[model samples]
Target: MTVEITGIILMFLITVLFAYPLGKYFSKVFKGEKTVTDFMNPVERFFFRVCGIHPDESMNWKQFLKALLTINLLWLVYAFFLLIFQDKLPLNPDGNPGQTPDLAFNTAISFLVNCDLQHYSGESGVTYLTQLFVITFLMFVSAATGITALIAVLNGLREKTTQNLGNFWNIFTKTITRILLPLCIVGAILLVFSGTPSSFDGKDSLTTLQGDNVQVSRGPAAGMIAIKHIGTNGGGWFGANSAHPLENPTYLTNMLEMIMQMIIPLALIFTLGFYLNRRKLARVIFGIMTIGMLCLVIPTIISEIGGNPAIEKMGVSQLTGAMEGKEVRFGPAASGYWSTVTTIISTGSVNSMHDSSMPVSGVMQMLGMMINAFYGGCGVGLLNYLIYIIIAVFISGLMVGRTPEFMGHKVEAREVKIATLVTLLSAFLIKGFTALAAYMVAHHPETGWAVQPANWLNNPSYHGFSEMLYEYTSANANNGSGFEGLGDNNIFWNVTTGFVLLLARFIPIIGPVAIIGLMASKKFIPESPGTLRTDSWTFGVVTLAVIIVINALSFFPALALGPIAEYFSLK
Candidate 1:
């Protein structure tokens, strides 16, 4: 027990220790400063020129978003068609079939948005051709998409007033060439060394000790698995995700994978400070975000480590904690901590089955997605936090009877409205969609739909309600983890959550970038004694309060209907 707790603490400390230096490196990358990866400059220039792009060209926020959306749309159309015809393409040693149209639509958007919510299983549903072209290709770009968009926000925040942030194509190219590509290369090597597969070999027939024959799926998984975590694009090479023995092989790999997922998200906080030259401000933001993580994770760890009381009611000893749906190699403590981290960071990878976690742990996982800002996903996580900060800074200024100024710009109604709408959109999508699905279950469970609503849920009553709620929440947060207790492979979930996934990923991103761009164009205000000290501990408390209140108001009732209700029912 003590050892597992220690290991969890050590994992977090190692990540932060590594993040500090990486943040410094990130600061340099965004500023167009020289770096160790300058060797990639030639490759970047060649790629840009081939694509008819000028790396030196600058763009305003609107133009920047235009380029981002245009490319994403192109990729979506390309991936959808390719997925629908994958079986006819190359790389099908396993003779895997092509995806159905609706599943293809959902899968393409899910990966394209950096939300790798798989409605179809990884190994069987996708050929190695689609896996490499659609899944892996999108993982790289979608993550780069979020991070590069964040660079725009960072550039805007750094300036007192400016119209253009930077060149989108240039930042995008450099982000992939210098940062993401190198990191994935290194991560892929480490994973392969640690027993993850890197081969293109198809299913290998084998006989177990009990003489039963099984065909185990194998492929070029190490490369995708690398960015799957490092980019926090947590789609798996296998259906079991990180829990698969091949994907995450050892205890060392578990720690390594978690650290890789967390590094950029945490480092970006410090990068924000370095980018703005406001180290104190970064510290405050990091402190608040860390506290948010602890609040969610501590309860999860304790509950999971405390074992299941319902199981304790039986004669079976549970001194080893709740081991159901968890890996024996990782143990409950690490799995509980992982459950919280993956959900909060929007990585959405799992080493344990979340549906089998204690109901209290389920609430924490949902809360992580509901809040959706603590450490967040890649470059986008910082963007999510900035929205909360804007709202907090605005409210704090109103209370103090002063103009709200953040980083030398006034907080106005336009910015606040954008932030509020983005915040409310999550509540709307999750609750609104879940309500519709629930209505279908109650009123039309036996409808003539292809996949009946009566069979949608794998559990009954309150726990069943949570399965539905968790799916949409995951989609809305752009966190692709599922309860796995929901039978969501059908058209109903695929199409509905498809729209939710699209709106949720882009809108929150658009809100922050737009806000920062607007603020960057506003007249600069010099610091006054009357000006709020945004970097102080006082502002941290205010931001924390705003996060709590907004999330509670937006999600508390829905939570009560799902995980909260189930927690007590277990009792």
Candidate 2:
């Protein structure tokens, strides 16, 4: 095995160790355990009193679910209205036009739900009010959804111990006030310093790119980009995306952006272990994530190291590595590393164009999207991982000739069914939609929505198929990273992609939240010889097998059609 691949396997083992403590901590916070309370109790009490919240009151799963859905729904409405009313809004630059109805609806749900599916240009059309609304409503809701997921998990933890999770109001207030808002504010400040535009003026700036005095469009870039990452949202303020210097100016800024995108998802795992009082479970999940990351890094390094054939044909000495569509400052190694990591974690921001990558490297990128979109999104990354944990528990139970239990919670038919549903939904949505899109594009050239000819070469190169597979997978998985060669902003793409985003995301979230609620209500079993220690080596192998097999099997046919087909064609 390659070093990167080996690293990935090792990383999984390390992640397993980390996850247990993290999950334990997560459970601890929700249950108001002594360790977490000793530190956060004073803060919680002070804030609850100041904000007039009843910390003692708790809500059931149904109530929690309702509030979570309602908040997101309202935010969606707000995002839609803002997009529709952009021209009339205060933030409009002097000459920009308003959005059409279909476009507005698509964009609203896309942003509010953290879908990142945009059909419109950011620089030319949006006014100040539109940008502000996107920042205020869409970004806020994007971050809010993460908060809601955490609250739901906490509720599950509380139910297991005290029969009451924290109240929705209290949880929401604390999460936003303490965690989301603070991170966003700090992130925004750092982004501004790094040169992401901080202006509301719709006026275009005069800039000489490659020497011509062209007009560079500006908006509330810093404000949006901050929460964009903090919320694990992948939307770019401009078409150039993070590849643009203005959006991602410095090395320091880039690192910060990457770290912030990952922090909450990782932290949530610790929270889970803490609440359950089973550090081992969290470690196993963490191990899986780390292993996934290690897998991501290797192919990326190899691809980058392989360099570009087309570039080589140009008589340029390929000094370092793959150069096409990648930043020289960050280089292929860093770009490849980030690409894999982000896809696995559900943060789809890219520093390089994935479309131009080498075939094998591109395959790994595709794989990450498969893992993320189907698994869970953003803060829900670990939640989806938890589903796999349940599967591991179940399989381990079978091995031991006993019923499987996780953290003393049983893995019954309903729980496994829901978990399975959650895993398969995104795969189905992605592959089915990709096939549909391919057919539509082939049959309807007049739609002007076909894959780019350059991207859809006659050859079956892994790179070519990766670009094709990436489009639907990214949409279906809701990762939002593209090979950058797809025409996804047209009527067909807009509507189809928008539907995939909504259904793929909300439905999967509902599944895990429901499972967590059910598990929380059940009684915890004491550890015994019959109990399968999930943190053990035997369990880890089973966990890895389940995740690897599920993703490989689910995406196999689609992968063959897209990347594999293209690879063979190339040969």
Candidate 3:
């Protein structure tokens, strides 16, 4: 237990160490200041020239969003068709078939939104061409899309008043060329050297030591795995995800993947400080997020390491804790930590099956996604936190006798409305969708879809409710991890969650960026003696309180019916 605890601590600390400097580097790259990867300037220039975009041209918030939506729509159309007809494409060494239309819709939108929720397994869902061209390609671009939006919002905040945030095309291009590509190349090389497959060779059959024959699946997985972790895009190259030996390989790879998933989200927070010259504010935000993270992670580790009490009554030894759905190389403690980290950051990649975890651990995992901003995903983490910050700023002002202001601009009714709507929108999508799924299970079980609603869940009653709730929460949070017990590959789940992915992924983004833009256009009010110090510990406490209160109000009831009730029932 002590050794396992130590490993988790070291993994977290190492991620922090890497994130700080990388964050600084990211700010430099965004600012166009000279850095190690300045050699990519020519390549960026070539792309801008080919696309006929002037890198220096700035855009208003409306123009920025329009371009973002337009390009994304085009990408969606392109990917959907290719996935539908993947069997006709090249790179299918195993001759895998194309995806059904509904599944293709889910898979395409899932990747496009940075959600990466796989209703279909990676090995046989589509061919290698689609995996590389569609899946791997979207992993890079979707992550860059999130980071680019973060930079754009930061631009709105940093200036006292400015109509133009940076150019979307420019920031997006530079993010890929300088940050994501270089890191992925290095990460892919490490994985390839460490025994993960990087070839296009088909499956090879081999007899087990017991003389049982089986065909093993392998592909160009190392590269996809690299982006999957670093980009926080969590669809796996194989069905078992990181739990598969070929995907994770060893304890060292486990540690590496864990660190990669977190570094970008953490680094980007520090980059906010550098970009805005507001290091103090950044520290306060980081402190709050870390505390929130600890609240979720610590309980999870303890619960997982304690094993299942029910199993203990069955007279089975559980000295190593609950090992039911976990890799032995990465025990319960590390698996618990990964579960917390992935859900919190929207990575959704799993080293173990979440369904096999204890009830308390399930609560923590769901809460992490419910709050959705503790550490968040690649670029979306900061964007989501920005929403909470605005709300906190407004509430703090109301408590005192001052007008709500963020940075220099006054936080008006407009900004507050947008923030409140975005917050409530998450609850609505999660609960509304889960309720619909539940109603279908209870009342319309014989509707006879691809998989009947009667067969949607493997576990009966309370545990079954959790599978449905967790799915929508994950969809709403844009976190792609699942309970694995849910029969969710049908048309109903695929189509329903596809639409959820679109709205949940974009509305929060649109809200924050719109707030920043609106505030930037407002009059800048200079700080006075009466002003609230947003960078102070006091404001940080208020911010954390607001987050806690809102999460409780928004999610506690639904949670009570799911994991919380299930915990006591098990007792």
Segments in model 1 whose C-alpha atoms lie over 4 Å from true places:
none
What shift in Å separates residue 58 of candidate 1 from its native position after superposition?
Answer: 1.4
Per-prediction RMSD in angstroms?
0.9, 4.6, 0.8
Error at 166, model 1, angstroms:
0.4
Task: Tell me the lDDT of candidate 2.
Answer: 0.68
Candidate 2 structure quality by residue, lDDT tens digits, 1-571? 2543444344434544543454454444445555533555577678888977776666776777787788778877777777777777665666677777777777777776665755665665466677666644566666567656766765565444444545776666555555566678888998887778887666565657577676767777887787777777777777766777888886557666766676667767666666555567566666666667677667677767767766767798877677778876666666676677667767677878777666666677778877772223556676666677787787777777898787667779999998888888878887777766565546653544344433343333444445556877777666777776665555666677778778877776777777777877788777787777877767777777888899989987777766556545544
lDDT tens readout by residue for model 1, 30-121 = 78789897788788878988999987788999999999999999999999999999989999999989889999999999999888888878
Candidate 1 global lDDT: 0.92
What's model 3's TM-score? Answer: 0.99
